[model samples]
Target: MTDLAPLPLSVLDIMPVDVESTPSGVLRATLEQARYVEELGFTRYWIAEHHNSPNIASSSPTVTAAAVGGATTRLRVGTGGVMLPNHAPFVVAEQFGTLSALYPGRVDLGVGRTPPHDPGVARALRVDALALDFEQQFAELLGFLRADFPAGHPLQKVAANPPLTGKPSLWVLGSSENGARMAAHRGLPFAHAHHFSPQNSVAALRTYHREFRPSEYLSSPYSIIAAGVTVADTDEEARFRNVPAALALLKSLTGPPEPFPTPEQAAAHPWTAEEAAWRDQFLAPQVAGGPDRVRAQLADLLERTGAEELMVVSMVTDPAARRRSITGLRELFGSAPLPQGLAL
Candidate 1:
């Protein structure tokens, strides 16, 4: 058995916009939370991009990455990730290259092929959205980042500016076997989206490890598992806190997405048998309990996945509750501390 020693932890924030909160308010909260987690000794903080989603405010992760990077001294900031087909590879290279230039060694660029929006919204963003070949786009993006355009390549004359001081660490995000193979083939780090697609997590990770090759960025395979979590003083309280996010995810699948509901709203919700079952199934992979229970379950998860790192996403609606959960996690995992009162 692998030793149950503490592993590296990070945060993946979707910046869920509550009904009463404005986009600006969500952004502010995210920045503050990033700083707080940095104090808790989190290695990195990542934001996701989602378009046309009422509940999620992070439409531009590059912009948010810059904000979070500027606010904290040591936390590595990145996207969890940017949907590459939405924009030109050159633009992404320039944007992340600029971030690397500003922050030096504290920048990361995680890329994915999944479109965050539906077909119509995707067309609004790019006229030829449906025709995009993600594999080709991904290769082009890497070429720009590495400054390795072939001698006669059309983009050889163009350079991503301001030039990167050092290449930002790259990660390929996926929830499928194909994504795992691609990341492994390229020798980039891989992050599996276990939080949302729990069923495929093990298969994807196994595929990545089997196909991995050593490269410039890493001498061995590195993988991170992104998992959803909710913790409180007791299992009962943790389950209660998770209600809102669970209801929000269910609504997103069945109808138009809404802002995260409050605990009271979730409590008052009229759940049918089917809906209740759906909620339980959706939350099967999540870890929610008091410190001891959470720690044991997380250790089991690490043993099963063999991940080098874990990136957690906690979606409790109350700010104080969220902070307390994060603080509890830090203590549970034995991460090092910052100055007193910083995390609180």
Candidate 2:
């Protein structure tokens, strides 16, 4: 009926290492960016987990979360998700338990099914049983967090220790309906990967709401949707800033990730017919514009998705441009922190 109000915004970063930057530099930049965004009133700062990728430095999101949590006092920090097949359930619980002990009331634990990279890489990651065992392992992880198991269950005795006052707020991260169903069945909050998989996002969120069953964790449905946003002083400049992320993503889909491309490289590259088409599709769901246009696009998206919160992935290659994008977006979320009830 009317324009939707600006949604509560959060941050999701991969600590991208561009062709011009080193992994060490990107890591340091992540800490700096986390503090900056927290000061801007972003609800949270979460890192994505990606491995065997030259462009992404956040190979272990949990550890990165610890670093981010230490760098900022108020922002909730956690994995946008941990790829569950990469680690044991007990170990994941233990790791987050330690984080909760340190951060308390500010940690979030979001998990997803693993994406098998290359064959060799998948083998090296020990994810051979990923597809078959994901649900079982996911269940095991929740059990560890809940500290509840059937009577006489062997896992009952083996608990994830360092028990603390707060358990990390849990979220199920997905790009498809399968994870939605899993999250709904468990009554955990769901976060859809709309930035990468726009086609499935609406369906996934609807599925989550339709099938949701209340559990000890939550009494109602809650969802967050991630979107790629690039804002600048002008629409043309915003498009220029977003080009490198689209190009790097296209390259990664075709083969192993290369160094994240720089804006100069993006400008120099020839846009073939098919590549241009692919880039258009990749950028279609994302928002890239100056202030007025960005506000309009975000409002339209909120009305369409009905997400309680929005997680932003700014895809600017230059560190300064990325920071500008972050700062530019802070106005959309007003000055107050997002109000949330943690289901810990």
Candidate 3:
């Protein structure tokens, strides 16, 4: 057993579109942030996929990954996840194959089983894209990665062309036990979405380790737990930064979705007794405060989960705060070095 300590840290950029940030600006900011984090010794930088979200600019994780990969040289770059339900596994394999070709040895393909949270966005991506079989999709994706289609299979001869120098290391992204079990059965690393579903993080990771079976990918369980963290130089500043996204999300539960609120707007918005409760519940999983406070909270979380790595996604609209969050962690954690044989 290891002592409670800093783990390998990775970045999960959800590509949030803040009020003052345009799509182009978001993309540019993402690239710039990726470069800075790599310099600070983050292990990997991942882009999350969210389709048709008025507040999320990362609709195409791979394209954005290419941009991030092109911008930074050392840290791993790939999707925090590409939702398998929305696209054919074959296409995903080819896309990552090309990505691996371009960046070789420095790509991590984190796959998710779910589709867009919005039903309309799912259908618009493709008919029945939301209801596809995740297990089958995962199997086919692996097959395509290695061109290992079984005899008599229609795609026996087709491969993810351009040729892969190496298959991107695969990690299963889950918010529940379902994803953890799937990853365990295949011996792949599992990443629990503790940021979005902290309630399920412990149980899901326990399931992964308990049921894990040896496979080519792993002989034991390995996991990354993602947290929604907002850290600033001062505790007050961090709380101030957290309000914008929380308020915007709370308002979004009703009919029309609201654009991300600025810090000023968040401060001025009237808070109702009921709305305050909802916001508190929503932010329950997040670590928000100064570097020391954030680190203490994260350390407590790590002690409970025993996660092999830590991945952070700050959903707030303040890009400067996000940058400072990374810098603060750099001071607290120093550096995170990736494990050997983590990515194939």
lDDT of 2 by residue, 30-147 (tens): 9999998887767888999888888889898988999999999988889999988888889999998889988888999989886565787678877676365888888888788878
For candidate 3, the lDDT comes to 0.83
Off by over 4 Å in 1: 1-4, 127-129, 335-344
Question: Please, what is the TM-score per model?
Answer: 0.94, 0.93, 0.94
Count of clashes, each model: 0, 0, 0
Ranking by TM-score: 3, 1, 2
Error of 2 at 127 (Å): 1.6
Candidate 2 segments exceeding 4 Å error: 1-6, 164-168, 253-255, 335-343
Candidate 3: which stretches are off by over 4 Å? Answer: 1-4, 129-131, 335-341
lDDT of 3 at 106: 91
The candidate that wins on lDDT is 1
Greater lDDT among 1 and 3 belongs to 1
Instruction: Show pairs that collide, candidate 2.
Output: none
Candidate 3 residue 202 Cα shift, in angstroms, is 0.5
Please write out the lDDT profile of model 1 over residues 88-127, one tens digit for every residue.
9999999998888888888889899887457777778873
lDDT scores of the candidates, listed in order? 0.84, 0.83, 0.83
